[model samples]
Target: MPGDVGPLAVDIDGTLTDQNRALDARTLDVLRAWPAPVVVATGKAMPYPVALCEFLGIDSAVIAENGGVVVIEQADFLSVHGNPDAAAAVLADYREAGHDSGWGTVDLINRWRETERAVSRDQPLEPLEAIAADHGLVVVDTGFAYHVKSPDVSKGQGLETIATQMTFALGDTVAIGDSRNDVSMFEAVGTSIAVGNAPESVRAAADYVTEATYADGFLEAIEWVGTTD
Candidate 1:
């Protein structure tokens, strides 16, 4: 069954990195020898995941911005959400509501994002969801940050698009993640693994939950999937 599986789609940030946000050397070594195609999916900016894929020698499509943008062949940026203006407006509303918002870091906070906008998750989700709904956008929690994008866009849709292009069935892909944003991909794929650091809701949505956190958890999930029938 391991041979039957297609590419391995892994989430960056909390799933790939430790608490300090750096990739573990041991995990990187495992990725270097990974048999299947590895796709980097994350709520971080497109460049971050793409660069990591390049470093790991992974030449597959990357799902970025909580599935708002998909990068194919490390060249073109396919906008899955296609509503950057609306996303920005919703973020502006969040700011007006006295919530701190930014696009990741303070320096690039004002920079324009083509598909999705990032905000602090410290704010209540209900009010933010209402604002996003008003602008036809969806709010996703990425553990570290909250992303606002189009309702039609999701990690599930991103994974589906990549699977179609790569000529693999959605069931053949294994999605690994550790946050609420990964729930979409969890629902899309036949096998979904959640890291130990994942919230309770995320763990419940996953087919299996790893005993370890961060990259250790990632490796655990990968080995389990490779050995299980």
Candidate 2:
């Protein structure tokens, strides 16, 4: 029942967007009409959540840069504590490690392209996987871009933080996603749903699968919830 639920935590990438970053009208409706608060949990940067809030007409919580940062309205709750100096230090370590391991440039954005080629070639999977594993980074396969981020920062970690801040009982919230990053959300929410077009691995981790993609998936999940509890 809605009475038991406090807030809704949803992912943004595959759950809401297609090959392009288009918002689904059906899914937007669910989010707009939700009686409880809505939280956008994503691997995107701070700007992403801000843009979504404006688009969705929602003024609520957001988890960005994976789980490293969080904002509710204009207030920041959790943070990755970015400092140019500190970032430089970490980047230096990353570069040396990447170089030693036969990895490419420490430039994350550029390295991602190289990583994709490696995955595509199916040659020396260990090199790519090792870099991520060594740094406790989770490799986010976005089809267009691969993200290697600190293990502690991600959609799942963001969901945990959102749930805690909202005082929402774990068994009362619903989460939706379409990738491995979403597995964390699936594990965190009372209901874990995947879109019909989700990867098999994602489907394997979900409690339910929708018959649509993007906004359609979100709408399906909402409709399912309306009928069930």
Runs off by more than 4 Å, candidate 2: 1-6, 74-76, 81-128, 134-136
Prediction 1 global C-alpha lDDT:
0.79
Looking at model 2, the pairs that clash are 67-154
Q: Model 1 misses residue 66 by how many Å?
A: 1.2
lDDT of 2 by residue, 1-229 (tens): 3654546778887777764658665566767778887888766666767688888888858876556567776444654522223333333454455433233356343231211111222223345556555544445564434445555456666667666766667677788777677787788778888887678988999889998876677778777877777
Q: What lDDT does the true structure give each of the candidates?
A: 0.79, 0.63
> Against the hidden true structure, what lDDT does model 2 obtain?
0.63
The top-ranked prediction according to lDDT is 1
Show model 1 residue runs off by greater than 4 Å.
1-5, 74-79, 102-106, 109-112, 123-127
